[model samples]
Target: MLQYFTLPVTAFQQNCSLVWCDETLLAAVIDPGGDLPAILAQAERRQLKLEQIWLTHAHIDHAGGAGELARTRALPIVGPHPGDQFWIDGLPQQSAMFGFPPAEAFTPTRWLDDGDTVQIGNETLSVRHCPGHTPGHVVFHAPQIERAFVGDVLFAGSIGRTDFPQGNHQQLIDSITQRLWPMGDGTVFIPGHGPESSFGRERKSNPYVGGT
Candidate 1:
């Protein structure tokens, strides 16, 4: 079975997740923004063997620690699509601008697309290229667990900001309605920040994209 724990990391309180397959004790860390020590400690406490680093996008608050973590553990980096390469390349400047710890950029072992599937141990997750938040943004959906790790796409009562470079409000709305809605209303989503919420709830109450 696939199980996960959400850990708030960095000053941004980015919700980094540690997802593992119970049967094999193998795991993957999603969006390790910073504070690598705490992340590694949690995985060790759970007795999970860290296998991969999966990113939803290359924003500073979501991907700051990926390079260091992957280099230290010799784990492969995956996802976020190819469109976020520019953001990845700007990690150093982003870190300085945000007052975050020094960050390094690294190449992903695999650049995910709309239909790619990622695996950890015996479990698999379907990847959806949900852009607008970032052109390369992707969401990891675990059908078996009815969970979607959506980064900076949709929130409990709002949607991602479309003011950044290449950000488009219409594109973000389309990603939410077209790519995310099909995942099922009952599915619980972990946003990049703040509390988790079900798609059904957001659909009925979210001011930005509700009533669809």
Candidate 2:
């Protein structure tokens, strides 16, 4: 079975998830923004062997610590699609702008696309290329666990802000309706900066995309 723990990191309170397969104890950190010490401590407490760094997008708050973590731990970084290459490249600028610790840009070992799959020990998660939040934003869906790690795409009552560079409001709306809606109403999603919410509940009450 796949198990996960969410830890809010950085001043932005980005949700960095530590996911692992209970059977193999092999773990992956999703969106490791800042606060490396805390993330490492949690993984140590769980006795999980960190193997991979998975990214949803390359925003500073979501990927600030990824490069450092991967370099130090010898872990491979993955996902966020190829479109976010520029964002990854701009890590230094973003860090300065956001008043975060100096961030390093990194090259992903694998750039995921829609319909791709990532493995954590024995568990498999499907990847959905959900843009709008960032051109290369993605969502990791674990059907077996009925959970989706959705970056700044959707929240309990709001959606991602499409005012950043290359951000398109229409594209974001389309991504939510087309890419997320099919995940089933019962699917629980972990957003980038807020509490988790179910698709069913969001659909019924989220003003941004509700009643659609």
Candidate 3:
């Protein structure tokens, strides 16, 4: 079975998830935005053998800590699609802009695309290329558990803002309606920020992208 714990990090309070395959104890940290020491400490306390660092997008709050953690743990960094390269490249500026600590730009060890599958011990998570929040944003779905780590794409009561450079409102909507919704309404999702919610609940009541 796959198990996870969400750690809210940085001034943005981004949700950084520590996911593991309980059988093997192999773990992957998702959206490691900041507070590297705390994240490492928690993993240590839990006795998790951290293996990979995964990013949902390149926003400073979601990807700021990735480079440092990868360097410290010698783990591979993956995902957020190829389109978010610009955002990743601009990490330093984003950090300065948002009053975060200095951030370093990095290239993913492997770039993911829609339909790609990543493995965490015995569990496999499907990737969905969900743009709008950021062109390269992608959601990680654990089908067996009916759960998703949906970056800033879809939230409990609102959708990701399309006001940033390269953002497109319609694309965000399509990603949610056409890609995310079909995953099954009962699916529970972990957003980049705020509390987690079910796709069913969001689809029925989310003010931004809810209802038939």
* Top candidate by lDDT: 1
Model 1, range 91-155, lDDT digits (tens) per residue?
Answer: 99999999999999999999999999999999999999999989999999999999999999999
Clashes of each: 0, 0, 0
What is the C-alpha lDDT profile of model 2 across 1-212, one tens digit per residue?
A: 99999999999999999999999999999999999999999999999999999999999999999999999999999988999999999999999998999999999999999999999999999999989979999999998989999999999899999999999999999999999989999999999988999999998999999987
Greater-lDDT candidate between 2 and 3: 2
Name model 3 segments beyond 4 Å from true.
Answer: none
Worst 10 residues of 3 by lDDT: 203-212
Rank by lDDT (best first): 1, 2, 3
The TM-score obtained by model 2 is: 0.99
How good is model 3 by TM-score?
0.98
Q: What local distance difference test score does each model get?
A: 0.96, 0.95, 0.93
> What CA RMSD would you report for each candidate?
0.5, 0.5, 0.7
In model 2, residue pairs whose N, Cα or C atoms come closer than 3 Å (at least 3 residues apart or on different chains), thus clashing, are: none
